[model samples]
Target chain A: MTRRSRIVGAGLLLLLVAVLSACGAQPVAQNWPGLTVGGGRVYVISGLPQQVYILDAETGVQQATFVPSGGEAGLPYWSPVTLGGDLAFVGFAESQSGTAGLYAFDPETGQERWNVPANDLILPAPTYADGTVYFGGSDGQVYAVDVESQRIKEGWPFQAEEAVWASPLVAGGQVYVASMDHNVYALDADTGQELWRTEVGGAMAAKPVMAATGEVLYVGAFDGRLYALRADSGEQVEGFDFKADNWIWSEVLLANDLIFVTSLDGRLYALNPSDGSVVSPYPYDSAEVADASDGLRASPVLAGETIIVTSGSGRVIAVKDAQRQWYWPSGLPQSSVYTTPVVSNGWVYVLLMDGQVQVLDSEDGGLQWSFSPPESQ
Target chain B: MGITDIWTVLILRPMLNALLGLYTVLGGQFWLAIIFFTVVVRLIMTPLMLPQQRSAKKMQELQPQLKELQKKYAKDREKLAQEQMKLYKEAGASPMGGCLPMLVQFPIWIGLYQSIIQALGHQPLQLLNLSQNIYPFMESISAQIPLNRFFLGMDLSLTPQQLGGLTYALPILVAFTSWLQTKMTTVGGSGGEGQAASMNQSMTLMMPLMMGFFSLSFSTGLSFYFIISNIIGIITQGFISGWEGLMFWKGMSLSSLLSGGGAKGAAAQKTSSTSSQAAAAGSGKGSQSGSKKRKKKRRRKR
Candidate 1:
């Protein structure tokens, strides 16, 4: 070969290598906060240069963005946005400024109302009840901040043995939270006093759910067991323990007499609310329904009697009366869905991992509209 | 399927399954599984590398003739190119022989890296992604979901920055091992004291530094892979070329950087003695035989 040709060949080879390397090392998207729909808007938190994206509920058009006050331009938002009254609360976990904490924003104007600083990461979405906002922090503390003042309530930060990743459930003047330290605590909502504590065998990541009767709370743990406890006394309910094949990362869903729970093992079990016995003959197996080998992470949402489910492999399906009704994308897996399906105004909003929102008809599961984040546009 | 889909099916999925299989067989010890995987991959690629080693040795031996041709055809670029090819054919050497093996391994390296990240599942989402890739038949591997990431007091899922303290040792070890491997395998006599030598020198320094920076920011699981891969590379080079090409102090010796030639002179003497020993030890090997036979032919021609 001529010297010139060899030089050209070498150059092309380097370019090919560079292109292949770039293609191979493409960054995997980080887990973003789940989507929330309320007050005519859809709220989403996107990763890498994280910002809160607000879209029109009906049109799926960009409305506004609320950027939290932090030293760095890009930081991940791990906790989902919680809307209460006119303000939406969200938390930033790892920040360059060391000022990682929660911020309250006006959903309409996309303006920050106030910011409360925390020492460690906050991975759980804040729970808003009455006039206070409660959230769990990586600092192993459950904190209550006044909704109006945006300051943590006096004597309000209750310490736990490990990071508090599960969102706090506030009901009947009591706050119920599950901690990674393998314990569940019932605390006084007024004074941050611990009322009762019960130890579950494994670390907890899913938020505890309260029964309609307000007497029992169900929490799932990494040990593959779901614990049903008396809400007031923190005592495990008799004959209510359910063992799953794998970790239960999704929150337990209570609908009427049946309780729906999804496990990392890819099966969705509908159980009797009182006895924890499997209610459905054929549990909604994600592996069978959506071909999702990873199972499900986003909690199942109920649209009327139709159960709307999203999988880690990106399939969105609606099951009604214990039968698979309709699914989105029709054929191939397009993207992963990490957020729970939000049902509002007869439309189910599904947030994909790539920061796109697909809105489908709740009754027939037909595609209604789709919205991509501003950056993608 | 698309290129990415093909890659996932053909490369990434198989490697991921292998990693999970190793993790399961190693009694759920992820770090040990990574080290074992590195060794296995190196072993698989070892045979493909023999031709490259042989080509490198031949090129090095043909350096004197190549230089003479260059000098004779200094102004005639076309003549120089033609003569170089003729000389290469006569010697049965390919200029691209050393690069072909690397090109073949590049895809495997990429696949291995993706497998490590996906299998480690540093984030919950990654774990979910891993679930989708796993084969249903691999029940033992699937049962070990959420593999324990804590290895020797360090969370393999966390970056050095996140772990803090002596966790910084991972990046340092990565850099040191990479530098040692690069120094050992870098062919010396082929490009004696010119742009090629300087480029090799810069690469020996830059690659390790770049990899160290990556280790500092990436998850410790990846850093572990890099460190293990480098250590394996050093061993592989030692077996292939021996220590003749290995140099601890090349550009600026400790004494040259600091006081004077006392340390530099001592280091030079030690390096020379070691090189001679390694050369003598490695002389009877496959590639070494090729160079030796060429030298005999050249001596007969003279």
Candidate 2:
């Protein structure tokens, strides 16, 4: 370990016994601190305390923390989002009551550029494509918000049966939302009208992963199944089951043709994209998987050949197989590290529930540094 | 605004959704999801907290001087006010350092409070002001368990109501944890800055009692965070200020120092410290450092 690492580690190691003294003895405070890095700045929004913060990507000193002046900083987006230009678009809902709006923020100041108003507080992650931002809402509508005007576009609000809980994916002018309605909707990016909406067994809670060639859309549902859909149309190409205990709330990680996903039963699964069958590192219980308190909200991020993911209690595992790999833990329990670990350059950044943003070394599950939002005055 | 809705948006929904997400990313078992959540929060807060910790230690170091000023000024009124302000300025301390850190924690505390209720099903009403939180299990569990478990008898809840021996281990733990916290933590005053701190005494007494009360009233899990958080805080404080305090205590015991008692101790100590440092620099031992080097250059001219 380096000098700084040793200081932090030694501080943590000293408290291990005391921290682990409780029954659940897990990490505390949960977060979905996914990375949206580029232009020397990294951005993340906290699920609690209802504020969004920006950091100096290199030093990690927080640049700002912004919350809507009028609304409560409540339930916003629950997944990692992709941003564009100076605008960072995330699923923007409020603490309670009213419509879930699409929140637009200035990455430099974390201030609101504008809010595209909607109906419920639950929000799906948003993706930028073809000059438009696409995300889902609890109002059971898939929304297309204009990036430039920061307003709900002229003709959109395609209705779905249930709330669109997962982040929306944009592939080839089509916005995809995996909804609790047990269906995945493929909508035209410009207009919110549905191109095609297909049901793939159970409630789909994760954003579908689109193929590089934009040929297939890989999505997972609570039924513990992974379905491959044709991009142009919403027809099922292939599907596989990761049947386990409760739900498969995470999205699929597609590395070329090898599809990786996890089930509520604590098993990491690998399936074939062509036929939804197991391939390379087929099926293995993660080196660290979810336990009773975790919902495994984080999606898997690929770091070269290894897949990195965090469990409910905040234990993050970086693995290539069922074989023992490297692991590090969030010292406190029930932290709810639902955010997917986002990798950039050689580092991985993630958010914690206790309002902490952590940076880790991808090669080993070692911590680089951790910072919290400025204690707002 | 409403507890139920706050619970929904800040705590329960986000926590569950994230938990659900982690389950999908890693494997089954909600515990891992919670773990992931915990690490993220700690790591994020670590940096901001370093400044807060330093402020806390500075507060502790100034306590003795402050207490003396509080006494000397207890009656003088005008001069007391002037001297105290000068002392604070000289110390370069914020009298209200504690509040800034605590204020910083308000949103987080609210978030945590909201998270537990929604995540556990105790209060879904506050979430997004929406009545529809698909998780039905919340209402059922919110009623029976009091949800509070004990880690060696500390009441995880810390509200004003709901404290007693009947609520399993939470109440006892609250008192014990608070005792340790109070004993270990240096001071509640504003690091000898800002305002007079009669309320701080009550704060020391009321916090644990309030925790005990809250434990009796609510779920054990929230109480659990409190217990762990307070315990962790004590540990961190111990590590950070232990040596300085030990040295201070030993230094105070030296010949003629202990004789000063309360007021005498304060004045004597502050003057001695300032004088001794100046003397050290004047004698050239401290000249190697930046500030002292400047003094050395000035002396060379003379």
Candidate 3:
């Protein structure tokens, strides 16, 4: 009732506002921008704005923007843009318009071709092979979409024990699915019948990559170990497991005879594909770089003989001959890198979580061009 | 370390670990883990919440005397302030007693929410963030990387709007339970007068609406936490302080009930009955008006 009491009341109200606003719901970056390079163009699936940017990979110029069926900006288009078979595919885990599915766009004009709706979130990037597209769904199933009819293949959508967050690896008539159920399954690609599955005892998020021999497959797990399984029977190979200090979420990159994998603990391991033995002077720790204390998350991209890597601390480093060649910023970066870097025409495209795209020369780690996409309308 | 680091170490990390531990123990049932975690947190915080409930009860007990003091010193502001403070002192109650404890618990509430979001790890980046917060020894949690999100036909990661249908009922239930908890802890006659009174009135309404809005906006898992936490809070408040203010439908408008007009006496009667019950529990000094009514009833029976 008193004037002082009124002042105190007003002050308390202001404090409540301050505290609530301070701990308020932040705009979360659930996933980094999905970036991939193909056909001389860099395709990016922006997270917050939910727009797909088709940029000229050489010049970093925006060639076309593909906004999916929903015009709203909040729909999730976090899956990597998959380019295959005359169409570019993007999967939205969930959309603000209450629709979720795999959407295909004409890469040339950035126009939508067809959308195959799914019952749940489409978390993994769709892999297009032969005439069909294979992708995993959050509903714990892998779907094969026929490109011609925009329909799921018959006897399809084989269910796994848990959600599949990793892109399916389609090779030699088999679909390899790594699921959160802690198992890697091999399914007959055409008939959607389970052939064999190997229990890794840890949830997997990284896509399975086949060895150059086409007889072995490599997949990483949250158990902090990378397992080598036979691509023919999905059985773990003896004495071929490599352990890391933390979770491996990045897809394993296979270049020539070496397998490059990054973990959340800032370690990058290069192993011989034949036996999972560490490459000499390998298991490079990215934290050794000054102010780059965060882990290495983005998968390494190989350009000619040079290997380009990005870290959660946002540093872009070029490594050659098992040595760090050049690192970017030389101090600290403004944003972290989570999306895998894309390499094309001697340029490495790194997309930071803050929507900044840095096109650095792959040979010297020099900044070639940089631009931040405009805010979503 | 800075404030953010301290918060992560002291609050976020511990909560994240405990919630994940509970998840592992609960066989990867994330919803059940959240519910159990909320109950454990409420139980742990009872010491802080007890003083707040008792303080509110004491303030409610002195409402009549406060009204009298206001009327007697209506013409003099300074005198009014002095008399109110003196009355509060005599009753061993402080008007600001609940504020400090409430402020202390605010961060815990926020931390609990943050932990839930981190543990859910619905998105890749969120999951990556979780990997950083997990304790080195939580290998079971590592093996169970992504927790199962769907429960009772609803995806725990999606908002009510995204879930749609029956999931929308969660926000309504959240608002109802929040209102019930607020009513149970609120001092009587907060709807009466004074700046403090008006603020309490506004808070009683705004807090539940805000909670409901948060329920609607946040993931269903968080909303589910809100409902369980509120229900526990209401029951805990009932045990700490007698169930005096929860007769919301009987009427919350103190001025109208005190105005002594027709049909309003029914609400007044219920209020006195509950107040007498509270007095019987040795919660407060009996009101003079209540004692007079008892005496009149005794005489009429004689």
Candidate 4:
């Protein structure tokens, strides 16, 4: 070929490459901020830039930040900053780079203590229990990592039939794992042996919550129903099935003798633990009140007799005795809320999908401080 | 509404729902649903592509005359262009005809890519966003909340780079099928000794490799879509035209194809022209001389 022809061919090749690249530009994964509060510090992973921000719990000011060293690009820290033992743990979701990792950091200084790559997406916060941190992996395994050794315990990563997006519930020598395979598994906490598995009507994404008595476990399903399973046998408790209109993705909060559950259909149900009966005139539908009609996603957090409900529509409501105490913003919000609000010392901290952290007075829902990460700004 | 809104309403929304519907029908087998979707899309697009394919075939037949015109007007570049246009006009062929089908396909590929990614819903945000796109009429969509993401021991929502090792086979198969389609539809290196041929030669080498690279970065489900779409393209072209060009082994080997040899294209064209001549003779049709006279008359009229 002549030089001119070669040049033209190369130019055309470049153009085609540009066009194809633009055509197949893949969408990157995004998530709401995963926030946890402990030791008077707020640990938040905003999922953008893959850094953990530690804030003063009282004032909501940035204290310290942790960024993984030599980190792979496009990996979102999806797991909430889990404070276990002396270290705070966070997990990076698997990316095209194939490196999903769990890292332990100094809760005070935000210094990395250790990191272990799981090679699969870690979606749920690691649950700390008795020197071992237990978390669910998208690879369908519940990993039990010893905090001291900073490694997965031998023969302890129990595999499920599907991805385990919910945190493993550990109570009384047993680990309860809810999987997308539509089954809740009870595994021996020490040896990782399966004790009993109960298949539910639909896939599960919410963490299983145990009753105050510790004998019954209540879990929500994508089938829009809450199933109460006997803790020891994985058998359904009779007369305790509460159905909703949409998927139940939030872990049911157990407080005030009421089992509080949020469904994607924007309704919040407070059921009696005995027979799954709705607290009369309860099951607050956000749509009936105002424009907060968008479905609820973030789990409700209890704050001194006030239940803080963060709606997917972005409004936050303080409910007490099945009546709304006060709702924030009173109008349109800049973005929706997906992260469950964390309450500490009478202050409610909500992480919006737009990366703003709104702090409010738990009693009257008054705006205290709104912090937007500098990186997001 | 905005352009993004228009795109979502007109293209993205329908494709997303159609894919979900297919996944439900295919028993939650995500990869199988992708293959079936590819076949259905190709079938729907075949009618729009038929005229372009026929025009491309005619242009391929006129390549020899176009090459002669290049030699006849070797120095007068302007005259060469005029003569080539005249010849194309006389033969009722368009050099730009093949481009229309490709132009039409670009948006579909883009929409399909977005649809596949959204359907896979690898993250919570993706799944939450999926609910918004689902039509209320698709009442079964909520029941199929999380479509199965696994196929053949691999996560369909993950890329080969994420899976690593043997999972790279998806991109390789994508390139292979793309090359097969190129071989079936392209005229090979026969229309030689020109800028267009040089570019065609370069394209025949680059297109498949580029597509393979794209699949490497895309989700494995999208890679499956590319492989299936290329395979469908090959079959569709073969049915629309004849299978002459696909007989790569007749006059060229693998090495020849890799090295940009003209033997494959020349051999394919030779087979095509010989068949036409034989049919003309069998029917007592006019010979090459008669055809030339008819072309001259047509050119004069034009």
| Model 1: residue B289 alpha-carbon error in angstroms | 7.2
Q: Model 2, range B150-258, lDDT digits (tens) per residue?
A: 2335333233233445455655686557644653454322223233332333344455665565555545555555566666656666686552322324323434232
For model 2 the local lDDT of residue A331 reads: 54
Report, to 2 decimal places, the DockQ of model 1.
0.24
TM-score of chain A of 2: 0.82
lDDT of 3 at B292: 47
lDDT (Cα, tens digit) per residue for candidate 3, span A6-25: 56656765676666566545
DockQ values, each candidate: 0.24, 0.01, 0.40, 0.33
Q: What is the C-alpha local distance difference test score of candidate 2? A: 0.57
Better of 2 and 3 by DockQ: 3
Candidate 2 TM-score over all chains jointly: 0.51
Q: Is the docking of candidate 4 incorrect, acceptable, medium or high quality?
A: acceptable
DockQ of 4: 0.33
- What value of lDDT does candidate 3 attain over all alpha carbons? 0.77
* Residue B281 miss distance in model 3 (angstroms): 21
For every candidate, the chain B TM-score is 0.77, 0.56, 0.82, 0.85
Residue-wise lDDT of candidate 4 within A289-360, one digit each (tens)? 544336788898899997888887788988877789899877777788888999988899888886788889
Q: Write the per-residue lDDT of candidate 2 for residues A56-120, one digit (tens) a residue.
A: 88878888865654556334333344578667765554443433566777767777777777776
